[model samples]
Target: MIRGIRGAVTVTENHAEDMIQETKRLIETMAEKNQIAPEDIASVFISITNDLNATFPAKALRLIDGWKYVPVMCMPEIDVPGGLEKCIRVMMTVNTSLGQKDVNHIYLNDAIQLRPDLMKEE
Candidate 1:
């Protein structure tokens, strides 16, 4: 079976280093929480708020040890009237035996406000 894991993170600024680090952190957390392997990932879709133009978040995936071949695409998020800023969202599709309900969704930094209900208290 294939499953989609959703994740979001916010960068303090629009710097390229911040974008790369935060995106990598978000993806790593998502994979760790869901026990996903790079080889099992089908593809990764990323969207960043219009305010973020420093760099492409997909660059983070390529820097991962085994994710060089994982298909990844990046685009700009819809700019709503009062949408969140400097936020990066990710949707990772992977081959897994886990059920939909068992999948874990990750939200970090200021992006946690995007999905408080899905977050489990630590």
Candidate 2:
């Protein structure tokens, strides 16, 4: 079955390194939380806020060893009024045995406000 995992993270700056690090953080957490292997991913779609233009989030994923074969797309997020800035969001479609309800969505840092219902209490 195909399952979609969603995640988002906030970046402190618009630098390429910061974008790469935060994007990696968010993707790693999403994979860990969902127990998803890179080979199991069908496609990955990432979007960055308008204010973050230093780099494409998909570029970071390409640097990963296993992610080279995965289809990754990057786009700019809609410039909504009052939307969070310096944010990178991901929607990864994975071929998994888990049911949709069992999938975990991750929202870290200020991005947590994007999906309060999916955020678990630690």
By TM-score, the best candidate is: 1
Task: Provide TM-scores for the models.
Answer: 0.97, 0.94
lDDT string, candidate 2, 1-122, tens digits: 99899999998888999899888888888888888889999999999999999877788887776777889999999999999988999999999998887888999899999999887655
- Alpha-carbon lDDT of model 1: 0.93
Q: After superposition, how far is residue 86 of candidate 2 from its true place, in Å?
A: 1.0
Any runs in candidate 2 off by more than 4 Å, and if so which? none
Off by over 4 Å in 1: none
- lDDT to native, each model: 0.93, 0.89
What lDDT is reached at residue 118 by model 1?
87
Q: Residue 122: error of model 1 in Å? A: 3.6
Which candidate should be chosen as best, given lDDT against the real structure? Answer: 1
lDDT of model 2 at residue 87? 90
Which TM-score value belongs to model 1?
0.97
**Which run of 10 residues does model 1 get worst, by summed lDDT?**
113-122
